[model samples]
Target: MKRFLGFIEKEFYHIFRDKRSLFILFGMPIAQILLFGFAITNEINNVEIAILDHSKDATTGEIINKISASKYFSINQFIEQEADIEAAFKKGKIKAVLNFENDFSKNLVKEKQATIQVITDATDPNTANTISNYINSILQNYQLDQNKDIKIVYQIVPQTRMIYNPELKSVFMFVPGVMTIILMLVSAMMTSISITREKELGTMEILLVSPLKPFQVIIGKVVPYIFLSMINAVVIILLSIFIFKMPVQGSLFLLGLESVLFIITSLTLGILISTISATQQTAMMISLMGLMLPVILLSGFIFPISSMPAPLQIISHFIPAKWFIIILKGIMLKGVGISLLWKETLILLAMTLFFIGLSIKKYKIRLE
Candidate 1:
């Protein structure tokens, strides 16, 4: 017990002594959370647009007024000639161009129908689709008001139930992803680099020659990381709850348990990396470039798996972060219990076993 405490104390010194790494470990979670929460979101607002109204009537004027009044769009430019449309788009001032057909009011009154062409830049498909949808919604509302006296034959109202995140809070989606990233950095990157540092400095050889068993030395090194990762998880959860007003829909105990499991899995991976790499730099590079990118891009963290190409979607299944995210979403948003998440939990367990087995095999090979 005394030896274990001393080892733990040494680990704390290593963590606290380096201000830069400590700052990165603690600061990155908040920074990433804020960045993803505010900056990278599916919702589009205040999109700049251009208007080309050939109608020059009450209907076209009202349509323009309606669009400009809404929060989603701002009428940045009004093009006179048809040729200006391409120029404005090329300059990138407008994302979409709303054009009212000639004699819109006259046609709507006499023919009981009107046509408006919404030309959108398809380079950014998501933004373009959102802009078009917003415009259509505004027009539909206007048409509903104008036709208040007339009865419509077909009334199709979309019953949209935004599952997982009912309120469409981008923060909800980010919480799990942020937590995973923090755990990955803290457990995998930090442990692997710290272990490799000892190897680089020749302290690892001394330890291996000491009375401490190989597993004991590795466990002593990893225990502090496990504790630190858990602390980070707590910090992130508290920040989400208090700072961002994110609710804990499921049991806190379950969340903590799953976090611990993921931390262990990450630490095992770190152990494997440390055994394979001779220097801290290599460990850090591998952890960041190899593991981090896949977690962020392929784990359904930043992009939806369903929308991805078929091959990519199949490949995403192998990412451990994907399972972790699924477990998190089920617990945090859907408020599901072990019954729903047992399969994911089992998969994580299997992955942890696989990583630990591989690390042990690699370590044995090194010893021989």
Candidate 2:
């Protein structure tokens, strides 16, 4: 019994002393909990939307007021022409639009019925569908209010017209996730290994001493992998489009730009890992433990962030993939341009700068 206890203590000593082992055992669980909390959720709130009130009547005004008062939606803009609804959705400014037909009050008075068109950008079908349901619920309550004196049912059926993806394909939800995972695996894992291999061979030190600055050398090392990861990204997109028939509603140029930015982010993160690790095995383990799990499980790729716990929901904001997946869905599914997605774009840019800065700092520390 004494010998067995001593053996266990010795093993624990080995684990605690190794930084990588300590990180894997302790740091990983904290990271997982935080990621899951922030990234997964089953609720919706504060959805952006537009209104096109052709009726412009007293009743219509009241209905619009009711919708605007609800916590589920924030009216981003008002459109005059029916043609501009498509334009607003393409710009990604609003998730849904409430279109009150021209003779809304007249029809409601004479026929006890009127049409309200709820147009939605269905890139992320879940969000679009939820917004429609919320609007419908509000309208149903309004119907009950106005018809208190009448014995007839005043039905205000909301016609939820799904734009971009009429069929609400499940594949559309995953294209961004799958592409993110693939690009992450390829760019991050390989870049870490390649850089660590150079470090092991003493080539990284030689390059550091060359005419090129450390940043230039690191960029030179990662440039080739960026091309390779881009190729992987293109292949994934092509397969998603051809096999799944997932529509690219947004600009392809913008999609390409976002993909490239993600690839660079992954590469920079991998470089940071390489700086901390001494061998290829160490780099690989760090990349897998640090980047891959958080991205795959906690990035809102498979799970809805609204369903997650409050603490985890708050923590998920720090994951880079969470923002990138959003950007992907907005472009590929919603057909939204950069104008509507600037916030997510800036988040990704900030993450990239952070990783590069941290990696450089570590590299300088090693030299001393």
Q: Which candidate number has the best lDDT?
A: 2
What's the TM for model 1?
0.60
lDDT of 2 by residue, 1-368 (tens): 99999999999898888888788778888877766565555566667789999989999899988888977777889999899988887675578899999789888877878999999877667766777788888998999898898887676767889987788776887788889988998898899899899989998889989999988888888999999999999998999989998878789999999999999999888888888888898888778777777777667787655555666567678888888998998888766788889999999899999998998899889988
Please give the clash total of every predicted structure, in order: 0, 17
Model 1 spans with C-alpha error above 4 angstroms: 1-153
Residue lDDT tens for model 1, 164-265: 333446787788898999898889999999889998998887998899998899999999999999999999999989997777778899999998999999
Would you list the C-alpha lDDT of every candidate in the order shown? 0.77, 0.83
Q: What is the lDDT of candidate 1?
A: 0.77
The runs of at least 3 residues in candidate 2 whose Cα sits more than 4 Å from the true structure, single-residue gaps closed, are 1-4, 18-20, 197-221, 249-254, 278-286, 293-318, 330-350
Cα lDDT of candidate 2 equals 0.83
TM-score of 2: 0.81
